[model samples]
Target: MDFYLTALLQGLCFSGIALGIYISMKIFNIPDITTDGSYTLGGVVTAILLTRHLPGYVVLPAVLIAGGLSGAITGIIHTKLKINPLLAGILVMTALYSVNLTLMGRSNLPLIGTSSVFTFVQLVNNPNQNTFLILGLIVMAITLLIGYLLKTDFGIAMRATGNSESMVRSLGVNIDRMKIIGLALANALTAVSGYLITQFQGFTDINMGIGVVIIGLGSVIIAEVLIGWLNITSVWISLALVLAGAVIFQLVLAFTLNIGVDANLLKLATAVFVLLIVSLPRLLQVKD
Candidate 1:
């Protein structure tokens, strides 16, 4: 029960990255691999600030800014330099490796005895319950905010830019600017996950963000499956499903671990699981 509860908390913590991937891949149609680096950038910034005795609230904006900047660089490369989106993300992600290392000045940083967002307010005596409450509220708030934004005119243009870039460009919507902002927003959200996870786990490592994109992608794919099955069209419903996907994804992993799967083979298992999720639909279509 405790193991599943922990996985539930982790799923909530991961909501940010899941939403980020939804925006980047579903809304913008970009396979932004910058997720890996920007995520660590968030953790690095959060760790550095918290170790200096900075409050978690104060550290939040710094993480968002750092993540946004990294994403903006990738957007600029893709839009201004006319580079392929995948290549642009790769270039920025590669550069962020050095940037994260330089910012941390070390490979690993522990956050023991430091105040975190989860510790910011003690509504309940039980730590796990407190964390669950806080995370639930935060995830809901973010989902509502993003849902409202997607219904706005600016967001409509952004979505249109993704669906029909040439059409939006013909309407003088400045697709390049939209792409830049969209990617920045996506990465900023991804960074928030870094901020949450680093504090939750009590440490931040240089390699913490490695293969992180797969988790986000897997979560988003799960959401997509639900969306198709339910024929969901409302933005609110869609975003909520994404959050559910994140939780469900984590729970699945926890279940796998509980079943005595080797911890060392977890990544391989994750890859296979995600591959099955991604390929199953196509396989079904072929069968039909």
Candidate 2:
């Protein structure tokens, strides 16, 4: 039970990244790779500020700004300088390694005695339970915000830009600007994931975000599969499923570990699971 609970907490921690990927990949069709770096950037910023006894509220905005800046840089390169989106994201993600290391002044920082966002939620004696509550609220707020944004005129334009760039541009919308803003929002949410994870886990490591994009991709794919099967058309329900998808992904992983899979092979197993998720629909369609 505890094991599953931990995975649930982890899923909530990663819910933001899943949503970030949804925006950039699902909505905008931009394969932004800045998620890896921006994730670590959030953790690094959170750890440094928490160590300074700063409030969680104060630390959060800083992480968001940092992540937004990283995404915006990729956007500028892709839109203005004509660099490929993938390469621009790669460049920014690469540079963020040094930035994160410099911020931490080391490869990892432990928050053994530090007070975090969960510190205030004293209703639960179990720390993990507290984490669940805190992260739950955060993810809920973000989901609603994203849903609201998608319903707005500008949000509809953004979606149009993603679906048919030429058509949106013909409508007098600045496609490049939309791309930039979209990427910025995507990465900012990714950073929020990092922030919550760092606080929950009580530490920040430089490599904590390595290959994290795969995890986000897996969660979104899970949501996609469910949304299709259920024919869920409500924006709010769709967003909620995305969050549930994150939890389900983590729960699946935890169940695998509990079944006596070797810890060292976890990444390989994760890759296999993601690949299956990616290919199953096609395989089933072919069967038809």
Candidate 3:
């Protein structure tokens, strides 16, 4: 039971990245691969700063800003330079590899003695409350803010831009700006998630972000499947479902581990799971 709860909580800590994926893929209709790099960028920056004894609050905003900046560069390349979105994301992600390494001054950063928000929470009260409670609150706050933003006029413009860039341009909306905003915001959330995960896990590896985008997409698909994907009537519910799905997916993996499944094959399992979920709707329609 403890193991189950721990995995669920750990899954929640990374839920922000899942929400970020939802924005990029579902909301913006863009397959952003830059998340893999930006996730490490956040973790590296936060870990480096924490190692220098910087305040945890300051590190959080810095990591978020760095992620946003990296995303903005990708958006500029895609929207302004007329590059393909996928290529732009790839280029930016590749560039971020060097940047993250430079930030860490090596291939990894360890937070052996540093104080993080989670540590502070542990100090303030029940040292036994678990790091997940703090992470859960942060995730809830981010989910609420994103949900509220998606309901506003600007959010409508963002959705319109995603649905039809040419139409948004014809209506005199700055399509480039909207794209930049959406990508930046999406990656900022991803970076924050990365920072939290590094703190929670006590280390950051440069290679830790590899395949992160795939996992995030898998989480979104799993959530949509579990929720029936029919009444995606509001952004809040969508975000909530994504988080829930990620936790459930982790639980499944934990169960597999318990059954002596080889961890080396987890990526294959994740891919198959995503494929199944993504195809379910069309398959059901055909059956009907």
Candidate 4:
């Protein structure tokens, strides 16, 4: 029970990355592979800064900005250089590998003696208080802010660009600007997730982002499945579903582990779970 609770909390905390993936894949119709690199970039930047005695609040925004800039570069390359979106994301993600290495000043950074947002949360000294509670609050705040932003005029333009680039351009919306902003916002959320994860896990590794994009996609797919593929009428509900899906996914993982599954096989399990969920609707339609 304790183990399941811990996994649930961790899943909820990491759901921000899933929401970011939702925006790129579902909303913008973009396969953003840059999330893999940006996740590590956020962890590296946050860990390095925290180790250097920087405050968590300040480092948090810096990590977000760094991730946003990385995404913006990918958008620019795709929009201006006429590179394919997938290829552009690949290039940016590849570049971020080295950038993350430089940010950490090595292949990995240890947070053994460092202070993080989690540490501050623990300072309350309440036995019942935990990092998950603090992270949940942070995620909720971000979700609300993003929901509000998506209702604004610029947000509508961005959404229109995703729905039909040509139509949005005909309507005098700057498609390039919309794409850049969307990508930046997506990666920024991803970075923040990475930062929080690093603090929760107590270490940062360059290779930690391996298969992260797949996990994000899996989470989004699972969320959509749980919500019955409903058109996201309310932004809050959409975001909430993302988080709920992540928690459910983690619970599945926990169940596998409890059943004597090899830890090394977890990725395979995740892949299979994602595939099953993604294909469920199609299978159901055929059955009907």
Candidate 5:
């Protein structure tokens, strides 16, 4: 039970990344790789501020700004510099490695006795349960906020810019600006996941964000599959499913571990599982 509970907490922690991926990949159709860097940047910033005895509220904005700037740089490179989106993201992500390392001054930074966002609020005696409640509320609030954003005019423009860039551009909407803001929003959300996960796990590592994009991709793909199957048209339902997919993905991983899959082989297993999820629909369609 505890194992599964931990997975659930992780899922909630990663909900932000899943949503960020959904926005960048599904809405923008740009496979922004900045997620890996921004994620660690968030953790690095959070750990630094938390160790100084800063409040969670103060750390939150700092994480957002740092992550947003990283993503915006990628966007600028792609839009103004005429670089491929993938390569722009790669450049920013690469540079972030040194930035994160320099900021941390080490490969690993422990938060053993430090206060964190989770510690700031004491809702219950049991730490794990308190974490669950806090995480759940945070996830819920973020989802609602994003859902509302998508319903606004600005959100519609963001979606339109992705769906029909040329058309939106013809309407005098600066598509480049849209892309920049969109990536900024996406990476900011990804950083939030980093912030939450670091606090929950009580540490931050320079390598923590490595290959993190796969988790976001897996969650988004799972949500996409369900959206297609149900022919869902509602934005709120789709967003909710994306969050659900994050939890479901984590739970599946936990179950795999529980079933005695070798821990060392977990990454391989994750790749294979994601591949299966990605291909199953196409294979079924071909059969049909």
Candidate 6:
């Protein structure tokens, strides 16, 4: 039971990234691989700020801004420079590797003695429940903000731009601007996940973002499946399911571990899980 609880916390930690991917991929129809780099960027920036004894409030905004900036760059390259979105993400992601390494001045940094938001939570509550509460609140607050934003006029424009770029452009809407803003918003959310995960886990590694995009993709895919199956139409409910999907993804991984799957094969298993989720719907539709 305790082991499953830990996995639940882990899923909450990655919920922000899942939301980010949902915005960029599902809403904007763009494969922004920059998520991989931005996730680590958030962690590295947060670790350094915390190591310098900065307050959590300050540390969080810094991580968010840094993450947003990376996303904006990818957006500019794709929208302004006419580069393919995939290639632009690859370019920024490649550059961010060096940027993250430079910020950390090492391959990894441990927050052995540093104070984080989690530390405050730990001080105020049971150590065992600290992660559950802190991560849960953080993700919930962000989810509300995003859910509200997605229903606004501008937000509707962003969604329409994704669904019909030519029509959005014909309507006097700036399609490029929408894409840029959408991508920036997406990466900013992804960075939040990185920031919290670093603090929650007590360390930040340069390679922490490795395969992170896959995790986010898998979570979104899982939620999408559930959303479709349940005929959920409310944007708020849809977003919440995405967050729940992240938890479900982690729980599945934990279950596999409990069954004694080799640790190194976990990534392979994740890929297979995502593939199955993505394919099953189409197969079912065909059968119907």
Maximum-TM-score candidate: 5
- Clashes per candidate (backbone, < 3 Å): 0, 0, 0, 0, 0, 0
Model 6 stretches with alpha carbons more than 4 Å out: 122-124
Encode model 6's per-residue lDDT on 21-61: one tens digit a residue.
99999999999999999999999999999989998779889
Spell out the clash pairs found in candidate 5: none
Model 2: per-residue Cα lDDT over 1-288, one tens digit each: 999999998999999999999999988998989999999999999999989989877999999999999899999999999999999999999999999999999999998778878887675887777777778788889998999999999999999998999999999999999999999999999999999999888899999989999988999999999898899888788888888888998999999999999999999999999999889889989999
Pairs in steric clash, model 2:
none
> lDDT value for candidate 4?
0.85
Candidate 5, poorest ten consecutive residues by summed lDDT: 111-120
lDDT of 3 by residue, 89-149 (tens): 9999999999888877889878988888887766346543657678778888888888888
User: What alpha-carbon RMSD in Å does predicted model 5 have with respect to the real structure?
Assistant: 0.8
Task: Give the better candidate number (2 or 3) by TM-score.
Answer: 2
Instruction: Quantify all predictions' global Cα lDDT against the true fold.
Output: 0.92, 0.92, 0.85, 0.85, 0.94, 0.92
Cα lDDT, model 5, residue 119:
76
lDDT tens digits by residue: candidate 4, 23-84? 88887899999999998988998888988888867898898899899889988998899999
Q: Highest lDDT among the candidates is held by which one?
A: 5
In terms of lDDT, the poorest run of 10 residues in model 4 is 121-130
TM-score of each predicted structure versus truth: 0.98, 0.97, 0.94, 0.95, 0.98, 0.97
Tell me the spans in candidate 2 whose CA falls farther than 4 Å from its real position.
none
**Candidate 1 at 135: error in angstroms?**
0.9
What's the lDDT of the predicted structure labeled candidate 5? 0.94
> Which portions of model 5 miss their true places by more than 4 Å?
none
- Clashing residue pairs in candidate 3, if any? none
- Tens digit per residue, CA lDDT, model 1, 198-270: 9899888999888999989999999998898789998888998899989999999999999999999999889
